[model samples]
Target: MKKTKLALALTSAVFASSAMATNGTNMIGIGAQSMAMGGTGVAAYFGAENLLANPALIGKSQGTELIFGGTIFAPDVSSEHNLGEPASPGEPVGKDSSDANLFVVPSAAFNSRINENMVYGIGMFGTSGMGVDYQDNGQMFRAQSALQILRFAPALAFHNETAGIGFSPIIQYGALDIHYDGSETQYGTFGLEDAGHGMAQGLGFGYSIGGYYDAAPGLTLAASYTSGIEMEYKGQLSSASQPFAEFGMIPEAFDDKLEQPAEMKVGASFDMGSLTFTADARKIMWSEAKGYKDFGWQDQDVFSIGAKYSTKSYWLAAGYNTGDNPIKEQDGTTTEGATINFFNNTFFPATTESHITVGGGMAISKKATIEGAFVYAPEVKTRVGVSGIGDDYPIAGAASGDYSETKHSQTAATMMIRYNFD
Candidate 1:
């Protein structure tokens, strides 16, 4: 019933798209309203913005609702590599690529019911996408920092007592600016300090679709998919000391283009009187995504499950997920970077890991509910750079094309607010 603008942009999602659910499921893993029940809203989605999670679940909405939230990411991305043998002194010593700092995100959404079985909505949010800052004096790592995508999407859903489903015609707007720090010591150009800031490119026009089924009263099944988004940009390539500035001399250089592929998800849920169980499987089509139109984005897949319990006063829940490397590496060197990076995270020797999540919500008053959640991912050991790049800066552990094998973990806290009309 109200005019909307902010939510239209939310369609782009928080990280890349909620389809990944790794970065912030607090918003969509449970949708906004369902989050009030703790973070398990797969089979049961209420409101329009949440439709981005499972359109069919929006069938649970009544009247109109507006939702908005954001996530603050504190990534501890640091690691170490072997200088040679286990007996060698300081073999796996400290490295420069640790923690790129912290990032805070802001987002919003809106929705309304068309009837008991139908609902329509729009949203703006982020997904499980990763961004790294290698600008710390080139340390020889990739100085690649990415852009944030602002989305605009419209969706419609249908629900019945027996089953429900929703579809959203989406248009994601993406803008990423990359800066690479390269062989500053190799070329004489290093005389003029500068990190190459590739001009900003626009990646737009992507879509998503999701659905759910109550196969039975206490059982629900769900799945969703998002299309790939492509970005093309042109700008001067150079790091401090005008290292890459030489390429800029061409003058006729075209914008660098990168493609971000689509993603898919599948989940299931069951309700038993006072407690409910939910689980999900997700896929990221990073394979189609290549940087500099050459390097490729690995295909990533994740699986997660959660349980919820409710009492007369509040509710609680928890979950877990597993991840693999997207960087398809063969020899010690990586084929993904424009010039050749020895320590790129995409293909570096990284370890697989699983995380733990727990959270709960309480009734604030007759018209509102407040919720909070916490997740502590397990420590993952992996390398974090391209082979040649690290050695160029003569960075630690980069010379022999060895990955900086180290530990990494991530966690987040969330709060949700809900109110009903007087």
Candidate 2:
């Protein structure tokens, strides 16, 4: 019993420490080196961290290696709306910032050469998530939510002089919680009350495949694909709570399953003396995913470019990444559409669209190196229901009004230490 309790506690803590969504519910990159280069690792070799990006790159390693790293993520998110009439006179319905702003995402990886033509690796990473805390904002609904995900990947790669291929089987763990205040008599003949489902957890499995070819002495091309991971957080979306049962607002078909979207990436790298340049194009299939599709999310295309200058003992890197926000304004003409829009803005606002990254690494010795990176995503603002819909959208359980706006931005810093054992 004690051992089981301890395992549960550790699992909870690990899930709580996961990060907010950056690129369509996924992190821009896995490690400091990849992040500093705008997450462009499909064709560039970056040691053990490559397990998540392009496992084939691990085959480029000359020896065994271990890496430990963490990211400090901070997101600034706020929401404002007059959609619902005040429950009481002068209840202060204005802009409110989310308190779920800071988190630490940790990662570790180990890679070793099995033979002249084979390499193997394993990695554990806090991959993606999004959440908000509006409970302290004094808003009528006091909406709050949290979604977190972590992944463990074990991979194998085969490589020869100028080509490499790899595969990774992934195990994923996820947690979700949602809460909101509702009103009685808001729906014609039904009563809606506040609801909270502490936290729902689940596990899923997936896979990734990648390959790289050295086309010439100084150029390389690569591509990778990650399959979607399907998870079911029981009692999260289809709970027997007041908002779901009493009011019958959410559709029964919308169940408790939320699938992580699949991703495809293609990239190229050119090396010139001591300088290297890389570019990557990626597609996130959110529109085809189960849960996000139900929430009206669209597919996203992301582009990234990076440059690095290296010396005998140190290296400097910089890059830029951009993507269209997957979530867009929904049709407010209907109560069902308006309700979906309301939840999208209030609970899961993953709206940041651009990122600037800078980083560097220094060699401490022949076997040890330290690296760090910083990422900044400019603020993005979105507004829904600009035109008045009605006074009562009971499906949303709040007063319907002219519009609601959400502003989101983020910053993250990562640090890592690597050791090579030859």
Candidate 3:
């Protein structure tokens, strides 16, 4: 029973917040334009997305605006495990993993001038989480796992020609699911009788603040901060463990809180002739987040640069984004006499480091416009010990203290339609 509980705890430790971008589960940018420009918007014009990117910029909004959009995210992810010496000779020495899938994320926003000095708007978007399906692969950790968070925010802004400020209160809802076949006992004797899986729904609250200033005639500076939200999920678990046993192994009440980390961003935009150039720096405080910190995940730094040129009825944009990996690679030997590194974050691999983006906008008429963007992140691979976040690989049906490696890559395309009012 103790062994069963331990396994359950391991499974519970797999909480990853939102989507996994270079910013560690957060998207590189908030809107189609932002995504196209390497996620930069702090000081640039991005319509209603200012609610999520930088509320203060909304103070500079003109007329009335509405936008709706979605991103088709396709990710390729895989893993591999190395057995130092097969427990049974003639058995396979190393194994490759096939799992993880594609996803679609949606967004919508609207903004209106409340008066000469104020603007109001609301937006809904997601850094939609990721999942893995390793059901067919035997003995691999995590038979299946998936998580995602969606946010809706309403914003108010006050601004003048020289400066502006804005605020947005955020409401968030999310779902989580995890499953692991327990029949293999290389780690413990708990098998199908303990076939473990947990499913739950949760809600949370947060807020964001932003400021923008026209530093000079043609230059603008902007800054924003988003507070973290504390979330507690209530649901059911398949494991007949402590929390699950209290309710007779049915859909009992299992509770856990995953703290979303705060974010800070600052940037500047320059208007030169028909072109606007922008640069932004962002930080994600993963160390302060609940599940991430416990897993030894580190904070991430993101730097972006982009440029856009406007014509009478069309615009073209491109940008680049890069960041550090949050999950640290593990090295050294495990207690079971196996050497490993890099695979430490297999369960929650949110480790894409850079992106290339390109996009454009076309005016369909005096009142409507269409914008589209494409983003690509090259493949990133990491190798680590199979023990998973630890030095001892006690997994059943495999060699003790084996090695595990994972690779992650993605491509995304997004489109948004905006309507304007005089």
Name the TM-score of candidate 3.
Answer: 0.86
How far out, in Å, is residue 361 in model 1? 1.4
lDDT, candidates in the order shown: 0.50, 0.76, 0.71
Over all chains combined, what TM-score does candidate 2 have? 0.89
List runs of model 2 lying over 4 Å from the truth. 1-21, 86-92, 138-140, 183-192, 240-253, 386-398
What is the TM-score of candidate 1?
0.74
Q: What tens digits encode model 3's per-residue C-alpha lDDT throughout 117-140?
A: 999999999855757666775555
* Per-residue lDDT of model 1, residues 326-371, tens digit only: 5444344432231222333321222334556677768778756666
The count of backbone overlaps in candidate 2 is 2
**Candidate 2 local lDDT, 319-408, one digit each (tens):** 999999887776765554455555566556677889999999999999999999999998888877633334343445444566667888
Lowest summed-lDDT stretch of 10 residues in model 1?
Answer: 3-12
* Model 2 error, position 280 (Å): 0.8
| Residue 389 in candidate 3, Cα distance off native in Å | 8.7
